[model samples]
Target: MSSAGRALAVPAASDIVDAELVNGDETAASGVDVRTARDRHLSAETVAAIEASAAASTRRAYAADREAYLAWCRQEDRTVVPASAETMAEWVRHLTVTPRPRTDRPAGPLTIERAMSAVTTWHLEQGHAKPNMRGARAVLNAYKDRLAEQKDEAARARQATAALPAQIRAMLAGTNRTTLAGRRNAALVLLGFATAARVSELVSLDLADVTGAEHGYDVTLYRKKVRKHTTNAILYGTDPATCPVRALRTYLTALAEAGRHDGPLFVRVDRWDRLAPSLTRHGRTIGDPAGRITAEAAAEVIGRLADAAGLTGDWSGHSLRRGFATAARAAGHDPLEIARTGGWADGSRVLARYMEDVDRVKNSPLVGIGL
Candidate 1:
């Protein structure tokens, strides 16, 4: 996870932190001392709570960003902490102008901005003033314009290639249905596309979230947006080969027979074709059943399936979401209905953007005309 084209140069805690974050410089730099900062000693539970404030992903990025900043400051012979607005501006300018030392590729606008955000986060966390970002943002906007003028791929708005119904079937064909991983992946793909779920929602789906419904299964997304416990139906498709309903049952039935009827619907599968059991943070095994698959792993599953199926185009986790909207629109499903099924807000610009790509050709005024 390099935000920039080049790696962030983030080291492990063993590489960065010493015994304490704020030690006996007599709390000289910041008023707060590490040991006496709070009324109670900072318990592991309290530390976990504080870190949980940001998403796991965000916190990771912040860590990398902080390291990147430190590395950059060391290279440039500048002050590290309590970075000034001028330093930020200088960094962005350097990122914009210089080719990556190793790869010789310039960092994209988005990457530069993210790196800046990571640095700003570090400053604020240490009780320092947030670096004014106006200069850095201006640099970024200029960089974006330069990339657009040069027709760089990074300049274009990112969109995943839609995995339409036929393509979805092709991807399913790539999986070895006999294995636990294969069946689980098939269920993951079908449920993803059928419900237009983001990978995050798909992984959060516990067994309890899925209930039997008329003609299909109704699933409630654990992480809701706009609405709480938002439920959607997975209807039976005409083809048993590609039907989401059958895929889910087939997959779950295997799990049930294995005596796994609880916890995460999706879990890690080892190379041995064994379902991975949930584990504690200490690397200790928790019990039977399994842990939720990571969003990254889910994306890899989609990508691997797409490649195996020989379906051409950029396919990732988001392809399921983008594909669902486009496929439903192609079928003449009402826009509001499509939004409802996907848990998108009615009239969402993001959803509209997904459909609009295909619609440019599909919905052209000249499309059905004699042309």
Candidate 2:
């Protein structure tokens, strides 16, 4: 938006607290007291940092949960904020019984947990007393048990299929390398797989984050789920056609030629084969993100490439991460080595899950036994 247009646009949901403060309001504009927001004496930069602390998707989920809870409270003529333990327990029950919009099924346990967390976050933000959730969790457990009895699909865990190095090569082979989009995808896939970086981390990379190293490029992942730690991992170059470093060099050269020497490492390509327009965190044409691709869009790039390669299974951006672990394990790398590349906590159950069954057939004890 232009200067005047920007000046006139309403504050977003996130900025409501700050807006009220800026207007010299003693109270909040939102119905909730927002005591926590009120109590904060942070600078605009600090507030912006706080707003950016959570991932965009996470913030959106919390907001949606708060809205749903607020709507239910208003509809049932119950208190909104500072909810009682009974109220919370009843709320979970309501979520379990109510059919999710369009879907006939009620909210699953994970959804219920997230919803509860949303309400908790809202209450905490307002400095309200934490509503005891023991009763609520008990109810959620019962719901899970019921689902387990029925063997509901919602009860089963879903995992992304791993796209091993060979599959990744296939994806690159099928991609139209003559185009900007293809080059970008090639770089994204290679770097993500090589480092076992999450889609979020992959998109979080800025041009400055990557630096040339002896064998490959050393990638500094500044933005991550665990804010306290920033990881530096190498993206080794090999096999000229599918080399992550080579692909990145080609992509970065193209990006530089387009006058994009800085900003996000990966960005959108317009249908016209040009760099996409700058986008804000909320996808407005202005603000922080100067054309960085969202996690969802990046995932689609992987899926689309996978489809072009005629590879099947539940491929996604996560496939790269999973593939890294599997591939590393197959190559006889230790868990510590794999963990270092991917930032998985030592002994993380989820990481262990990915490595499970990977060597079952290949390294079976019975393989060399005589029949």
Candidate 3:
């Protein structure tokens, strides 16, 4: 008649098998049926549904955090059941201030706040009287504010180190295009700057995707990041383009000359006619493994290029993308246009960051000045 009695009546063959697998003959001899160990308060279907709503990455993180939280509760002799508002609040507080054992670092407010939210949601869905998460919400807000401050600080620091587009142009000009590697690097840099592409998008390109037209060639950048609004609109190259379309065209032609087609536009070439793993088995060679290039690889490429060009700084692949956005804004391109080109979902925020940097450099008294 009771819920616990009903749960006990339902057969759980899988649970018994799992118990036998873990404990061998210990569970069978004790006469303790593992099938009856089910959480009578909640159905297995409910738990499964909750997990289905989460993304794969989210699920993994939540699982790890949940295990840690439950283990801690067990160690402290606290109830693992999220059956009351008080219990939920206690858990949220514990997560907020507790130092993680392995890292010995205080759990970041956002990380713990997210874990608490997941737990609260799960508990509430299972008909538990969990807290409303208002406290957790406040902590999350504080965490975001901290992040914003850090971002602002980073933007300022980068502003001081930011290179001008013309400076990048100067560096590009130094590359000796006579050799295959030199030509490839030049093309890579030009495409990276011109498209304002993430290093991943830049590297994932194929020769087939790039086409030459009478006016200029179009390098169809798939999986590009652009403003959601302008996603429907096709953005062509800038007028009076800073870099020539001929440059890209010439590079593609060079690839053809090398007898490479139906593969990555950028191949790893150690010597003449020698190819590297830049090209996948599918006949597509990526500039940076189809945008999954490690930070290390990106750093290596930037460092090598910078060293060769005799330029100084800790430039990385991101610098190329960021530099393009910064330069475009300085050149008087509309912020929305920059966002559309860069595949940003929010244009205003990105524009504001760039405008702030510009103002800093110009010492413009009217920075953030209203129209």
Candidate 4:
């Protein structure tokens, strides 16, 4: 039997139910056998899974772009299924000049590229022939070349600022441990510095992912930049003042006092020490209903704390993680050790780049001079 025929030979019951929910009576009304209808639905699902295999954030952006492109096509009276090269090129022009609804700024080169990728993916999913070498892609490449010659990409790009350990310590000191929010932020800053964890990994943490050790805690991160190196070792601070483990314990105690045991390790709260109401119940306070703190919110919290501490310069969610690697390198730890601790893959040049500024001082020949 052919591949398609073999796949259709078996239909799971859940697939049928899902198909029914989606298609209503349309499939049934067509006089097709139930098995055939279910097989077709399952095939569609397989195609969807294939498309969705990309990162969650990428998939979400693609889905949104797909909708936006379709809307634009409808408004322009253009065909979207097999969007001609001309249509694609025209859409690229629109993306370049159009200000995003939220940001009110024209789409950056990266954003435009992602939008184009989404459009092309949609066309591919529809089984349209991809004349990528000759059509919209060619136009995009030429336009990109012109853009490159016109703009200094490096000058326009945002540089990643590495956080210093002292700055993080100052931020932690600025947090008010007396409040639930402060306690959470304290732990968050400490963990970010200690583990050098990406913002997404930090926000995805749950109460169950951490374990108490004699001196510190072991946090098992399920996702990170390196898939296999998810387990990170977090050490307790020598001082009670800035200890991440103690800060985390205090935060958990606050949660327990409020009758929350398991869920997001960090949650949103207002100034009154009241937790953000769970979205599931909508205004009703119910069991462990605190929602996950978003990455943007987490970064905003760090920025506010930094501002309060009177720390100057541009800080970001990546600051603490960068600080960790910077501090570790300055303390005489080797690159391999730093990479392992920061969840960086073996032989990662990115680690070296992060420690560049710090190394300038430590590895300088002036260090041994009699000045």
- Give the per-residue lDDT of model 4 (tens digit) for 3-100: 22233344434344443445468867675666655545445556555544456788688889888999999999999878777888788778766778
TM-score (C-alpha) between model 1 and the true structure: 0.74
Poorest lDDT segment (10 consecutive residues) of candidate 4? 1-10
Number of colliding residue pairs in each model: 0, 0, 6, 0
Off by over 4 Å in 3: 1-133, 136-163, 170-176, 224-246, 271-273, 277-299, 307-314, 346-351, 359-371
- Candidate 2 per-residue lDDT, tens place, 142-166, comes to 9888889999977766689898988
Question: Candidate 1, after superposition: displacement of residue 175 in Å?
Answer: 3.3
Clashing pairs in 4: none
Query: What digit string (tens of lDDT, one per residue) describes model 1 on residues 99-215?
Result: 876668877776777788888766655546678888888888988998899899979776788988889889988689999999999999999988899898899889999999997
Clashes of 4: 0
Clashing pairs in 2: none
lDDT against the true structure, each candidate: 0.80, 0.80, 0.60, 0.74
What TM-score does structure 4 among the candidates reach? 0.68
In candidate 3 the C-alpha lDDT for residue 241 amounts to 28
